[model samples]
Target: MGLLLSSCVPTSGGLPPFVNPPASTPYGGEYANEILKLPVYPRSRTLDKREFGNGNSRVRFRVEGVNVRMIYNFFTDQIEDAGWGRNRLESEGQNRTWQGVYQRGIRLVRIRVQQEGNSDVYVLEVTFLQ
Candidate 1:
């Protein structure tokens, strides 16, 4: 069984919205913050991170012992609360994948969560677009 929650918020014109830190600080620490510029999920293990320069970057991490729905909600709520508007959200039960796109001014962020094989681990990827 699977549950999916999705929403879309209209974008507004003006200065970029201020990004508030997540209520519970992420476990990825400073490095994760520097790379993704967003709160890493608590207790997540970073698997890979890359910078494409010009303010474009991507980070991949593994979240263990948690369901896909929880992780997806965490990031979506956090992003919306931070003043970013959601442009799109989608989830597929069969593949166990969830994705959301949020934007604040010229900054765009894409977050994806997918189950890894048959393991209980889920991999989350966050991409920051310039």
Candidate 2:
């Protein structure tokens, strides 16, 4: 199932930063920022990606670590530190979702983090709305 899902994200030719990520990612490892076009959570792997006609981008990946809370916190800080607004459109742990929008007009970016059920790995989805 992991293989099937991961492979769904095709490595579009002529694209930079997204080298074919392993269908199955290691639980923990050092994944450099240059390798991932956008900033990624520590030890996360790219599983799927989509770019909309309007230049928006959505990248999906999985991450595994002892602290899901830490992962969520890191994202929050980074997004805001990166100039994203503090407006967290939605946040609900019971639903296991955290999302926010940043950079309004022409460079809008949205980020979301969600825990995938009982699995040790969670999904990190980011949309670059430009």
Please give the CA lDDT of all the candidate structures: 0.40, 0.41
- Cα lDDT of model 1 overall? 0.40
Task: Give the per-residue lDDT of model 2 (tens digit) for 1-130.
Answer: 9988877665565434456544655643444442343433554332221221133332323222111111223323221223446435334453454565666445555656554433334455656656
Relative to the true structure, candidate 2 reaches a TM of 0.32
Off by over 4 Å in 1: 1-94
Candidate 1 is scored at a TM of: 0.31
Estimate TM-scores for all models: 0.31, 0.32
Pairs that collide in candidate 1 are none
Best by lDDT: 2
